[model samples]
Target: MDKKTIATALAMIPILGVNAGADSIETVSNPAPIQRASVKKTVTADVLNVRSGPGTTYSSIGKLYMGNVVEVISESGGWAKINYSGKTGYVSTDYLKSNESSSGGETSKPSGNQKSIQQVTSSILRVRSGAGITYSKVDTLHKGDNVTVESTENGWAKISYSGKSGYVSAVYLKFVEYVDEDSSGGSESSVIRGATVQRSSKSYSLDEMVEVQYIKAQNGGNLISRNNARTGEEVFTTYIIRNAEPRAYGKPTKDELRYYLDPANFEGYSSGLMQFVRLDRYTNTITADSLNKYFASKGTDCVFNGKGQAFIDAAKKYNIDVLYFVSHAMWETGNGKSALAKGQVVTSVDGVTLDKPVTVYNFFGIGAVDGNALEAGKLTAYKNGWTTIEKGIDGAAKWISDGYIHNSKYNQNTVYAMRWNYEYSWHQYATDVNWANGIATMMSSLMEKYGTGEGLLIDIPDYK
Candidate 1:
């Protein structure tokens, strides 16, 4: 595979990937009511503040603009306790006018586009497998999530998300005017809203192969067995270097290699690699506090606090090497400082050149410029629960685990084999001859700081 074929294109676009699963909430809110009983009420105010309680002192959780519709649960002292999204909140009774036409009764039948788009009013709403709360949650949509309504049944709205249909309570649904932001076959947002349909099977290209392996690893299908410890460690080492080489240069020249291998820097890189070796055995044990502190030390402005939890979850869920995964993300994202890491870039699979760009929160730079980047981005969109940090971390971990560690096809499980198996393997992950050494240097650096261990005692022969 021509690695640069896709990477070069991605380089042309702005890099903007931010971690969106961090702790941004001031308080954790509860899910909305499940019982299907309520009276219709419309918000008459231009903007009505939804509070946590039925008083002036209650914290405002969200806002509903004029013409917004909601289900009134009960009446209070000039306040209406309403069901918005999946959460219960209070609004001023004066601003809520009772709809006698549909009060405690079925809504009038929908006509045309009025039934097509529904505005999500809840702060956080779950898209379920079935209509009721008993049905498992397939995904969650935020306050402003776009829903292309397909149909409704018994106060449950069936809407499309990333090409998949799921149910949301109709009580929190509001009919909004249709806005044609992009008439050119919908926007990247539209595609991401329902992007999970299985692609047709074909001869897998390099990117496609990465995608397959990533998904498989995520599903816990492709995992390194304990019996394969020796081979797994070797493959893991190779991946570290493959990732490290991209940091110095696409293909480092002799001087560039020397600059990277200077005794001072080499030791740091080696420490980085050794940390991976130690943490691979630790599995998914990273704590949220530890991760948050690390990010804070690095000055990374993470959007969500659950990111650390997300990494730990992915590591535990997929059996991926935690230290190596975290370090690789730090390297790629500049400790989450890069534009792509910060979630600033927005474009379609074609990147910034497209007519309509899709917001991508890919931390590991997956599918950035490649056609697969868009698909990867959509799969990791917030709606799918693979927010930027989770997407980047999990996607990269799965790719490394499936592509190198315990690779069934190439059998180049060792770093030495991956670097020198030119005659046997069709493609080498990194072309630089000192790729392994470079990663070993990074491993040394990481270990020197955050961990304690003997560095990788590897010998390197310099080429002049």
Candidate 2:
């Protein structure tokens, strides 16, 4: 039997653009109402986008491109019900070739009881907090963390991170290493220069060593931790599409790594993802007290002390959840969108000249976003404020309404409705998952990788 498509707009309650339409103009005053009852599907697609509405022309919300590997909600006509920039929207299903029989199409509203299984990568790698370079160590590992390789984006590998959304550099991490060896030896054990080799009491049988290499025996031996060699920018191919001439991305790649990795780039900055970030917003936090402190630490960027203090203050204000804020900053600002993608993606070409146009800085993912919000509050996402990161993300799950639910949406489940706009065409269905999941993905990845977390799940910085 065909599911009945009811008109929710008549009720005055919203449902991800699912509300009553073509009814009475008097009923059209509310903001994007949220929720749903059923979902369309639960299959991954080649490319998907969560859009602003059920039809194209609304706007691009997020990109979910990856061949037929990207999972998504079921189908509505030829369109896939998608999450449009933290709201409920739909995208064309023409791009996806893979199909799975799951639920009705409801992108954000999920009513079923589903257990989450993490996606772990093949190799063991370093996990950090705060999405950018200055990651505070959370935990170290030896692979098989989450137990499965759920997804990949650009160069960022998404394993359970620790059950949240942990990420590692795919280029340096070694997803899978295939090597040809000379026979004759079963298993050989060698130590790094100046290191000693140890043997374990859980003795391995001859059958255990495939190509036996000589083993070393120590009194009461123990395995040693390796040094960090996977440092520096990884040169992996990401469809992220960077700009060369005229404009840039997030931050000039150089500035991005420098600011986040080096405490100095933050010399004159303030606290909170918003205030301390954008170059124009620099004056707010760059006080004399800030500068002198940096001069005492690292010593090199002593000249930049005052500038970086804002970050410290912001960290204090938000407490532990501060890391969650970092997720959006690093991704959008590329550490500091001021230098990298500032011009390239934040300009007039995209339609909305973002105030601080960078890849991740598109807070609220306001593709073609220009200027800050007309209002200044938690609700307003304009300007270089956490509001950009906060609302676009925190409100992600319930972004839609109750009138249009299909009962099968989970962060793990993919849907491609962000591609409803011409801007997101290359990323049809969803341009990328990094986008679709929003800030929730940030916290999820952080804790997953680090194995540590604190504070609120959706705590955004205060808006002024």
Candidate 3:
């Protein structure tokens, strides 16, 4: 959608000449009592100037890019006033038009049972008094904690925890199916009746390992080969189409990921099967405080202290999932203790020698690898950024945001989806079959540990 005011009579000087003024000036007199309904307009220009006043004489304070929607406040001769970036500004009336877009053409909202069971997948999930992060922490729950779901709203689950009902992030809760342990086997796995079953043990038997390996080999090749395939031929392929001069790829927001992954509702899928993840799959609610607190809980000094704010900043700036990004970082850095997290030497870039020796302060270990097979990947990331902590976080965030989480090309949002090699048969993020699942586990653990209570920030800072 685009928005702007009706152009002044003189705005047509180039097309209509000086004579176009007096008699040809188009006027939009202020509507009496104004339109009762708020007017939402789309910007039609590539870059429409946002002037401080309703005339061309007004100074340009900012810009309203094409497709940007703004509410029309009032109008003068040929100018429309609007609230731009929190301040009143005027855009040429010529570029503004009523928004005609639908809700992405969805015919109905997502449907689910009114009340259902969900398990806390986090190691320690904080129960808040309300739905938003600003709410006070009233209680806490642990990994494998079973709670009765009373209701859910806006990424939060209202549950009956510890004899009291409170709200927790729905992202950390997994839908489960409750079941009793069978007497045939001396083992018991908690089945919550409706949730996806949690894998009982991290370790597998020899037969199980062999079977997994066979499956992987059939799917691709060696485990290391799969791990090295993240930057495969598909990395060079373009997916998202941007509108800017450089025409870079665009990333998906959480909502967009949800829409694309939900095959039941959206029609843009090449495969109708919802192979990405479980129904409850989502990005955890992570913050800077969450990272710092998780680091402190480990009792080891980490470079991530005072760095949570940076992650939070980058997450918002890039529209990436804060929890997923931080969880992946923590997993790669061992809670910020890894040498790669501190900084590493980047000997070259795209196999070219740098003018001077360059070091990368990578947090997520994007291109870094231990073996000779993946050295070039590290250099590829260095050229993109990762030289410093902030650059590393932002660069890696953008990469993940555009590639794994919400790439227009692949559109794989879930970790399981990342392992899926649908289009390029060789594309996968890790060698081990459990890589995506392991990251999910780490995300839950981190959120349980630092996502709630005193560790949770009541007032998350808005960097934007």
Report lDDT (CA) for all predictions.
0.50, 0.30, 0.52
State the number of backbone clashes in model 2: 118
Scanning candidate 2 in windows of ten residues, the lowest lDDT window is: 273-282
| Per-model TM against the reference | 0.34, 0.21, 0.39
| Model 2 quality (TM-score) | 0.21
lDDT of 3 by residue, 1-464 (tens): 22333355446444433334455544344334333444666566756888888677779876655444566777766688776534567888899866543656322111322344455655457888988778899876654455566554444667763335888876566554323321110111121111122221212343433343445455444232122333321121111001113432233333433332232331122111112222112223556666777667655566677778888887777655566677667666666666656766876665677788877776655665446413544565566766777887788777777676555455455555565444433556755443444565554455446662111111101111
441 in model 1: Cα distance from truth in Å? Answer: 3.8
Q: Give the per-residue lDDT digits (tens) of candidate 2, residues 1-464.
A: 33333444445454343335544343234334234433333323434555766556577665443221232344554665543322455667666543233475233212231212222222335655533346565544332222123333333444442134454543223222111222110111121111111111112332222112112102111111122331222110011212222221221222222222222232221111111111101112223353334224424422223333344344333221233333433344333332222222323222555566432223223333235321222122233332233233332212221111111221111111221112222222222212323333433343334323221111111111
Instruction: Show how many residue pairs clash in every candidate, following the order shown.
Output: 43, 118, 24
**What are the per-residue Cα lDDT tens digits for candidate 1 across 1-464?**
48887898867665544435654432233334344457776666767889999766899987776555677887755777887666888889899775554465545332322334555666557889997899999876544344666655444677764345788886566554433322111123211121111111122333433343334334432232122222222333332333343232233333443343233343233332232132222332345666666666655364333477776666665554454556556655555655555664444433435576445465666544445544554544433334455665666666665665435454333343344332333445444444444344444444344443421112222122
- The CA lDDT at 112 in model 2 is 31
Which parts of model 3 have CA positions greater than 4 angstroms off? 1-216, 219-284, 299-301, 346-357, 373-378, 421-424, 452-464
The superposed Cα distance between candidate 2 and the true structure at residue 454, in angstroms, equals 18
